[model samples]
Target: MNKILVLAAHRYPDKSRISKAAIEAFTGLADVTVHQLTHAYPDFQIDVEHEQNLLRNHDTVILLFPFWWYSSPAILKEWQDQVLTYGFAYGSDGKVLHGKKMMVMTSTGGSAQAYTPEGYNQYAVDALLLPFHAMANKTGMLWQPPALVQGMNDATDALIDNGVNYWLERLQELRGM
Candidate 1:
């Protein structure tokens, strides 16, 4: 089975409902590590070498976060900026992530309808995630379709649990675990 690294980034852990539920669903699952970015670097200061080492150890990487302003939390962006250095995560000499699988696992406060072309956001989740796909391509990693939980702010406990189960099932299916 492929080892999975879940890089979770939440702005405020105390106020997190979806992120907490998602993490709980994956707890104790074999070959899975839930690394919380906010907890790891509270001050937004990232350790590039350490982050890269974690990447090198995982077979599949899942970026889990709540969509904020149509993008990831600032800390995740900072982590990306610092850790994904040239000649390391990209460039001719950057082959550490090559052939590995990667995907986004996210939740959005807005309803699914709001993310459509004709909706409020005027773009689908996949469209909003094009940059991630591009990053995966640049690094020679296999890009998997994202797993998302929509309308999270309005989601009930049962709905959140269902979303958690859905994500867990999808990940297991991907790894045949």
Candidate 2:
């Protein structure tokens, strides 16, 4: 069975309702490993060897984060800077992640409608996340379609339930990969 690693990054995990639930639910999956970035590197000091080892062991890597200020949390960027190093991830001999699958699963405070040209955010979520796709490509990992949970700032019970279901579907797809 292929192991899946979820690098979950949230600045305030407890305050994020649906994210907390999603993290808990995904953590229960047999082949999945959910690593909370903020919890791991509270001091912003990442253990590069350890993080790279996690990537080496997992076949699929899922970047589970909140869309904070149109970007990922600080730790996630720190992770990329530290863990995805020259000799490990992208040098002449660096191909540890080659052929692996990478996915983006992010939540937004605004609704889906807000991420359109006609909407306030003025761009599609997919458009905003092209950088992730490019990152996956640069690292020689297959980029999977991103799953977005929107309007979590005012989530109803129904929205939360749907978010759970959406995550379940993504997990199922991960197993197949």
Candidate 3:
């Protein structure tokens, strides 16, 4: 089975209703490490080497975050900026992440309708996440399609649980590949 690393980032852990519970749901799962970026780097000081080491150890990487303004929270961006350096995540000597799999799992507070040409956001969530696909491509990681849940701000507990299960199932499928 392929080991999976979940890099979860959220702005408010205490007030979280979706992302935090999703993080908890993955607890105790074998071969899966759900690393919370907010809890790990409270001051936003990411340990680059340690983060890189974690990436090196995992075969599948899942970036889990609450969709904030159609993008990831600030800390996740910071983690990428710090950990994905030259000669490590890319470039001639950077082949550490090559052939590994990666994908995004995010909960958009808005409804699916909000992410459309006729909606306020004016684009699908996938369109907004093109940068991540590019980053995965640049790093030579296999870019799996993202898993997104929308209208989650008012989601029921059962709905949240179902969403979590769906992601877990998807990850399990990836592990076999």
Each prediction's RMSD to truth: 1.2, 0.9, 1.1
Report lDDT per candidate. 0.89, 0.90, 0.90
Clashing pairs in 1: none
Task: Find the candidate with the highest TM-score and give its number.
Answer: 2
Once fitted onto the true fold, the runs of candidate 1 whose alpha carbons sit more than 4 angstroms away are none
Model 1 agreement with the true structure over 9-69: per-residue lDDT tens digits: 9899657887888888776899999899999999988988889999999999999999999
Tens digit of per-residue lDDT, candidate 3, span 15-94: 77777777777767889898999999999999998999999999999999989987999999999999999999999999
Segments in model 2 whose C-alpha atoms lie over 4 Å from true places = none
lDDT of 2 by residue, 61-130 (tens): 9998899788898889899989888778887988999999999989899999999999999999999898
Q: Counting only residues 3 or more apart in sequence or on different chains, how many pairs clash (N, Cα, C under 3 Å) in candidate 3?
A: 0
lDDT of 3: 0.90
Model 1 TM-score is: 0.96
